[model samples]
Target: MLTYEEIMLLITALASVFSVIAVYYAIIEKNLVRAVVFSAIQSTIYAFIYYMFMAPDIVLVYIPVAVGLYPAVILILISKTEKVEKQ
Candidate 1:
């Protein structure tokens, strides 16, 4: 059985891996808003990793900026430059 610290490390590693995948999806997605939302999901996972490391301050800031404000701004910008995708 792994120790508590080892398990936490594993979880952090997995979070980073998933974050990378989210970033890849964000880059390839045709929809700008969907890509921004995927990036938010990635940031949320990173916030969870920070929380696991006992860093509440980072979690608070990251959650608001990365998961909340950043996406909101991007969504607003997308709305302003709205273009219909051929599907």
Candidate 2:
């Protein structure tokens, strides 16, 4: 069996990979809403990694601002403009 630290490292590594994927998709996505969703996904993965690293305080603050508030604000701004990005 893996030790606690090893397991945590593994999880953090996986989460980092997923966050990178989310960021890539967010950048390439044509729809503004979908991009926002992808950005949120990336932020959530970062929060999880933060938790894995035992940073509860940072995670607590990050969850609301990055995962919740920032996305909500971006979505509202998106709603005001065109849904799809023009080439």
Candidate 3:
């Protein structure tokens, strides 16, 4: 059976992988909306990783900053940008 630490480590690894993938997609995606969504996904993974590390306070702080405010800000920014032209 896996220990708590081992399980947390595994979860953290998975979250890290997700974060990397999200960042890659965000950078490569042409659509502003898709990039914003990817960035939000990355933030969520980061928050999960922080929770796995047993930093609940960090999770608490990160949740609002990452999952809440950041996405709203990104949405606002994307709304301000001109429409994307499809290739």
- On TM-score, the leading prediction is 2
Candidate 3 residues 1-87, lDDT tens each?
A: 999888878878988988999999988888878888899899888888887777999999999998899889878877888545366
Clashes of 2: 0
> Which residue pairs come into collision in candidate 1?
none
Model 2 per-residue lDDT tens digits across residues 9-53? 998998999999999999999988999999999999999988988
TM-score ranking, high to low: 2, 1, 3
Please write out the lDDT profile of model 1 over residues 1-87, one tens digit for every residue.
Answer: 999999989999999999999999988888787888899989899899899999999988899899889999888888898733446
Top lDDT: which candidate number?
A: 2
* Clash pairs for candidate 3: none
Please report, as a residue range, the 10-residue window in candidate 3 with the lowest summed lDDT: 78-87
Which ranges in model 3 have alpha carbons more than 4 Å from their true place? 85-87
**Deviation of model 3 at 52, angstroms:** 0.8
Can you give the TM-score per candidate against the true fold?
0.88, 0.94, 0.86
